[model samples]
Target chain A: MTRFMDVHHGMEGITADQLAQAHQADLAIEHEENVHFEAAWADPESGTVYCLSEAPSAEAVQRIHERAGHKPDEVHPVPLQV
Target chain B: MTRFMDVHHGMEGITADQLAQAHQADLAIEHEENVHFEAAWADPESGTVYCLSEAPSAEAVQRIHERAGHKPDEVHPVPLQV
Candidate 1:
């Protein structure tokens, strides 16, 4: 599995709890797509949401997000970690 | 310029102010390398830090981080934004 980081924008004013709820919604169906969301971070002020996950491909990550009703603005492969 | 997101780990218990200071330190030298750091997000509990920037290459991003004293575990190009 490869690590991926996806971004969601236009989420200005989103609360942490709301983001968590969305994450939970994703988690509820992620397994069907072979994706596992590991963590999420949100900057309510910037309206940006970031999610880290392990998935077979970026497409799988996007699919999971799409099903959860929040398509990512970008999905990039995390090639390194320290 | 392409947008990139980089992650730093093992930052457990770091405060938002500290991260901002580190980010400021990076900004202090970013111009020398033609990198522009746009935003940063930190999850203190998870020891995770994410930075968004515009740079010529991921290597440039790493160089900035290296100079600022914190090397990212991974730097990925942000290919899309919505």
Candidate 2:
């Protein structure tokens, strides 16, 4: 499995509860695509959110995210990490 | 303390050991600025690194990162998270 860092833009003013619900939405359906979302953080002012996940492919991550209701703007492969 | 998400670019060929050393460097001096770095992940192929930290301010996070040898390209305040 490979790790992925995905970014979502234009989500300004996202609240803590909203973010948690979205994360839960992803987690609820993650197994379908074999994606495990580790964590998520948001810069409400910038309308940007970052998600860290491990999946078989970026496509899988994107699929799970899209199905969860928030599509990522960018999905980068994280092959090496500390 | 607020969580911050910092990104570092231009480190395309970083290896696992190199990444660990960089994280260690930050951890070694993080307490000086009251910054606690939670984790770091890198996309070696794209030369991008993402760092997650809790600090008094974004500046504190930046200070520790700069002292550690890899200045952040962008440091976004993470006020909302899940």
Candidate 3:
């Protein structure tokens, strides 16, 4: 699996619960791809949501987001610790 | 290896060159830890630098940042693709 980090904008003034709903979308993505959401967070001030996921391809991750409803500003691959 | 994504404030209005300097610092950390910097990016408007690193510990990544001159606002672990 490959790790990817995606950042999204336009989430300002959004509540954590709303964020949780977004995360639920992520969870759905995780399930569909058989990937894992290692970590996810959103900055209310910046309206940026950062999510780390393990998947086969960056496109696969994006597909998950597309299915969810939000489009990402950027997605970059990551190297794992172990 | 663990993948960690750190978000930092005070990066708004920061230049990509400055962010690259920070990435150089990250590279130094990767060297020290014998890890890899899979991907990294910064938003000039938001001043957020997101880095994905493969390291042994979260503290090790933080240590890299401390050595570099900027501290991370948050670090969350990520799973590997393969």
Most DockQ-accurate candidate: 2
By TM-score, the candidates rank as 2, 1, 3
Name the docking class for model 1. Answer: incorrect
Q: Alpha carbon lDDT of residue B72, candidate 1?
A: 98
Which lDDT tens digits does candidate 2 get at residues A1-82?
9999999999999999999999999999999988999989999999999999999999999999998999999999978766
Judged by DockQ cut-offs, the docking class of candidate 3 is incorrect
Candidate 1 Cα outliers beyond 4 Å, as residue runs:
B1-82
- State how far residue A45 of model 2 sits from its true place (Å): 0.9
Rank the candidate models, highest DockQ first.
Answer: 2, 3, 1
Q: How does residue B71 of candidate 2 score in lDDT?
A: 93
iRMS of candidate 3, one decimal?
A: 10.0
Write one digit per residue (lDDT tens) for candidate 1, span B1-82: 8878788889888875688789889999999989999877665655777788899989999999999999999787654332
Worst 10 residues of 1 chain B by lDDT: B73-82
Relative to the true interface, what fraction of contacts does candidate 3 keep? 0.00
- Which stretches of model 3 miss by more than 4 angstroms? A80-82, B1-82
lDDT of each residue in B3-67, candidate 2, tens digit only: 99999999999999999999999999999999999888899888999999999999999999998
Candidate chain B TM-scores, in order: 0.97, 0.97, 0.83
Candidate with the larger TM-score of 1 and 2? 2
TM-score of each: 0.55, 0.95, 0.53
